[model samples]
Target: MPCAMAIWRVYLLPLLLLVLLRAFTSLPTQAAARGGADPSSGTDDGKHGSFSRNLLQDKPEITEEMTRGYMSNSELEIAVQDFGRRCANVSRVYSIGKSVNGSPLWVVEISDKPGKREAEPAFKFIGNVHGDEPVGREVLMQLAYWLCDNYLKDPLATLIVENTHLHILPTMNPDGFALRRRGNANNIDLNRDFPDQFFPINDDINYRQPETRAIMSWIKQEHFTASAALHGGALVANYPWDGSRDKRKQYYGCPDDKAFRYMASVYSQSHYNMSLSKEFRGGITNGALWYPIYGGMQDWNYIHGGCFELTLEISDVKWPKASELLVIWKQNKMSMLNLVASLVKTGVHGRIFAADTGRPIPGSLMVKGIDSKISASRTFGDYHRILAPGESYEVVASMEGFTPKRTRIMLERESMNLDFILDPDGAAGQTKRLPRDDCGCSCDDDGKPFLIREAYLWLYLLVVFFLLVLYLLFRRRISSRLARNPPKRPVAV
Candidate 1:
């Protein structure tokens, strides 16, 4: 019985170990199989798979006939093309990206040097964030046309065209507009699709909507100084912080609260009747004070892109009659122009240079009281820092391995032009590089890379484990052979 037990330990034990190893190796495969088993499962795969399934199952199809008078998706595309051709000198139209339903997100860039880069600030106006709020899309198109016609004709228009790059995305949610819904075709709200400060819900880039991703990518590429998204359902201009730390319905302000309030007032006060709103004071409201929401694009722009963005609720009633569209455009036209003009009209505009080399260096600009900073452009070393005017601010310009320069300025109603020539620090010899965004490299998405690294690690472990098992098996077999046939006892000398 003892001999039989030893035999089992040698041969059977090895076989048992092999079975355990195989089971261990198959775990990933089993998990993958289970994941693939239910193709229609409501599991979010970070891309469009899960949402696409949900769209097909739950949402109702909207036909072109249902949306009359308004431009169809194809018509909107045609209008963009026509504008590009008609306003060839002042405007250059381009597509930022495509939506989930494969519609191109078109942008009409209005500038004297339309497609060229300059030391000037850039401002973007995104319309139709929610599909059902189609007023913005229409109003934006009118704004584009007005700019095209009035450029070199209208002083304010020429000012914006010559001094700043104005990018207008007419319909961010074409898929949602086609469906006539608040959310996109996948039933996801684009406003709530951005990365939230208080929550990690939208942190995964893979799970983001194509429209939201497009906006994020565009912001990185353009380096906008300030921006606004046209929405409906209210009449006041909204600014960050869109959410609160405690998740309560209260007035939670961002670091640049004063500046944001000024920006919001620019839009609201410019509007024909926005200032007369009894619901919101001064025709402007803090976003969180009204109602807190997470993953809003307005707050994300301020935090991540270094752009002062306002959520402008243009119309009190969303989806108003088609005829009212023209009236709405007329009402909001000055607000749009003044907002774009604000980048040039009221802000601290400057370029940063290396004192030793006399060459432009991408640096950062900050105000004394403001907690946030804006980066200078790599090509021109130009930075546009928007602040509430008529105040004294100690402006600081900083760069890696350079002695930061500081200046005290009493910024007035007119925009202030200030330049900084940073000297190389004697203590720090070599110049340290700035972050990708600061260095002018486009860091589009924020998705983490741990999954890929983990996958490689598991593969490495599997290869090592298999080799270890093979080595043990070979050793066991050699030991058994040596035990069965021992050499002639070394032929005793």
Candidate 2:
């Protein structure tokens, strides 16, 4: 028996090990054979295509059977147009630009004052950033219809529609959706096509995809306060900094980390069972902490556009069954509404004006400790600064050729209105002074002239005058005591 065992170990054992190794190696081959084989993936620019991790491992190949009930590119456009006509009172449909394959990127602007500038916050909801993640597109359409259907019926919807300009882009990658691929017709990831802060790969504006260029131009044209892009394959509200300077996987937060966290919490807590997530605490995460990726849309929106953006991964399954889309929409409806309402419901909002002309001035806003700045709208001079409530902040409003004004406040749960009326810097005999609170502040108060630059000298003279008055009062008190009692004074002498 020992001799037989020794022979088995020497010969048969080696063969068994070889068989196990072959089985282990064949697993990847089987996976690739199942979904990763795409023949028409080469870019229009004659470059080889590379698939994202979601395309290969996270999501299976999108078959026709899986996308039966989903809307085609043309169908989505028609639905957008139909929504515009149906909700003509509060919605307008316009095309931002076209896709690589010449598909118009339709946008539905829903507001009480659509296409007109108002002293209100503007929010954008971009869906279908990735062509395969069709859930966002469907859910966004549902959001639009729900808002239209419940405009005055539901208080939340009414607040969102009446107070905020809600822009909905259902599909950013129509060509990719048509191809049933992750990237656009050029086989490039739209999310990664934005200019990155850490890496300069996307710095060349000429090389950007058409869809990316459209979004960029839209941001430049409109002053959005905050925005969110919907995605799938995970369930978390992702905030920036998406990539670290060292390119390491760690928690790298943007300058407005607290504000971003609060914004993320608002979405996660509003979602059904999102805050109960076990994978992500509070169902929110910093983007880089999860895994660093450069050139993400979330960070770019914050950095370049001054728009607080959240990359919301709303579904665990990338390409869920079409039947499940409604359920997903129901799950995230409140989150979407609350996120938009947050623009008006919370934070600091106001407009800047020139004191001399009493006209709106397009100024910039900044917080004392936060290393970021946002600009007011050119048309209305309105600015909205989203901050974490229950904290104190020193808000500053500044413009060129005008004196900067600042005020400190303890931001409560409700939103605060703090407008500034900056005086011309060349104005003479005006002492630099800040207003006491968030109420409107101006250089001139009730036709009273402000003090000149010799403020400290005036303070010194006032102190001396006060001292003289105190001395006189003390002498008067002494004389009154003497007059009353004749001082038993000399009695001691």
Candidate 3:
């Protein structure tokens, strides 16, 4: 009996060792499957390290008449051509240049009124500046398809295409995209390659790549009103000019600083779940250079071209899976439409004052003509509002001391300028009010004030609560596991 028990123990010990070995060996594969780190590469164990694998293995094939989340260089080319063919009335494809590897750099222009392209202000969207950050390319491609397909059905889409010229270069670095490398075929970072008239290029970074030169030339010729370059690895919309550092060599603010703030705020409000007015409190950091980067696309666009350019880092993960593309598309599509549509027409500026006291009244003013919307201006004297063109509309100004002023105006033309002065009795009196309809006339759809969307606010709160609950559950599980398997003690000192 003793001999048989010994034999059983010996066999069981080897079986247990074999099972442990298999489990240890499978850890890397399991991690990769969960979108985690690659054990083979001794790098940081996170989304960044395994981004390429996720991109390559998970993306689906592109198809015509249907939107796809993932695509390769050749697949994307075919998809773009198909989109052009399907939406021949509203879209056109143009070749900007060729990559170093002889791949064509394609731009898909989407506009409802194709013949009226030259007359309108163009807004360019480029993606995949870093080869590994492919989410932008997918998102832009999806947007192009959406804009072209839904032109007649969707009011916002129709409005944008009818008013503005949207130029989308889905892949800026085809060679790098093909190779899945951060740098182009020539091993140059395209974002840093723009011509710096003041700061000359040096060996620390190479800024004279062919792709960058082509982009600069295009910008000079196109005179785009606003542009956005999309990237990944960080989830924030960064704006220019990004080359400045403060007295401590810490990343600081850009020049033309106010414009940067305005544009960044616009982007955050339109897309991310954060306040546009504040910086870095929620959502993502804005304006301030929290990271050190030089010769980026946004800085070049703002400084040289005098255009409002933004760099939208779409996801915290380096290369998000094809499945995650749709979520990103939903978040960015409206913002993209808003940015382009806002540029088609300009804003109207005016001042409000008390008719009785002849003093400026500061308060909230609502402009409802082309579009029913409200805008607030510095109440002390001047107020500026932006609205679209149509015909009959009303402008109402309200304050505590002054009676709410309401006036009717007709904007038959494309742009109109008008002014107003409010009487104590909420009537338009005989005072030469500044033109309220000045500047270019365009509709302002800033959406319901943050308070009115109570349902959305509650939904957001619920999501936060759920996430907190999940975190606590995960923390407890980890704690219990640690307690059950405490670390083994070392030998006596």
Candidate 4:
């Protein structure tokens, strides 16, 4: 009986414990893969994620066709291609990746020189994150078409087309749209699918949906000064930190809280009625303050891509009548244009170069008080920093091997272009090494390796436990042998 019990304790106990641990950890993974929370309960948008989708969904099926008069996936592609052909000199169409359902994630680069690199800031707009909230997709297409039609004719459009590279991804979740659900074909919410600053959910890149991965890859390749994602269900501009550290719902702001607030307010104040919202008090709420959601895209963009992103809930209704999309586009047009134009119209735009060789140096821009830093372009050493129109800011440009340069610029309502030629930190020609973003510890993704190290501690603990089990098993066998034979009393020595 003791032998049976020992065998069970030595082998079955560890196996059982292992099984329990795996089951414990897999709960959130399973939940996330299945769309994290129930969309029917309005958990996707919380107070601001979705609008009265329940009431909309309650309508008769006969009205479905009328409500969905928005462009089909194929129709949108045709529109994109037609615009590309018509505006070939100013625009180009390209695909970032494919959806789980094999629909292309198309992007329209609207610029004077669409595919070329210039000393200009890049801005991206991602729409149709949720399949049910199709307002963003239609509005984005309208935005693209409007830009294509008005470029060289409209001053604002001409400024954007000539000075900045605007990348418009009309629909990010075609699979979700095709399925008419909040999540993708895998039923995963793409917005809640990023690696969270608080929770380590979706840390592994593989588990991220194809659409999510495509956006991640795109941002990594492009240095966007700022960007915004379009959403429906609520009329507000949402900024991060999306999740609080204590997992509580409250106003949790990141390092550049004021800048984010300003960015969000830019959208809300520019909108037709967003700034008049009674609930959000300016139609802009800190994401976590609205409701804590882990693994959101806005926070990830700010943290990893070094881009300022606003999650704009542009409509109070998730799926309004197709006729309302033009109104929606009109409402958001100025906000969108002004937001992108702010990159080139205001703030400080500059290039950093080596003082000795007169060569461009890929440096980073940082305001003395602001905690965040923006890396300069590798090709042109160009950097664009967006600040409120009227302010006196002491901006600093830094490179790894160079002595950082500081310039006090009193930026008025117009843009300031300040170039820096940094001297070597020590010797005239020698350089000091600085950290790279691709290092195992990247500042792009929150400079903390604390989470990964904490996760590794579990493997270390498991290894220690396995060693303890082996040691105990050996002792138990020795004890049983000694009990059985008494060890011959050491031959009476």
Name the better of 2 and 4 by lDDT. 2
Model 1 alpha-carbon miss at residue 329, Å: 0.8
Score residue 350 of candidate 1 by CA lDDT: 91
Model 3, CA-based lDDT? 0.60
Instruction: Provide the lDDT at 439 for model 2.
Output: 19
In order, the Cα lDDT scores of the candidates are 0.80, 0.81, 0.60, 0.78
lDDT of 1 by residue, 173-254 (tens): 9999988887898989888777776765433787888999999888877779999999887799989987787877799998
Question: How many steric clashes does model 2 contain?
Answer: 0
Q: Cα deviation in Å at residue 64, candidate 3? A: 24
lDDT of 4: 0.78
The residue pairs found clashing in candidate 1 are 46-206
Give a tens-digit lDDT track for model 3, residues 251-299: 4554334444555555667885534325454344433345544556676
User: Which lDDT value does model 3 have at 24?
Assistant: 49
260 Cα displacement, candidate 4 (Å): 1.6
The TM-score that candidate 2 achieves is 0.76
Error at 179, model 3, angstroms? 1.5
Q: Which scores greater on TM-score, model 3 or model 4? A: 4
lDDT of 2 by residue, 36-109 (tens): 41121111121111212332245468888989999998899889999999999999999999999899999999
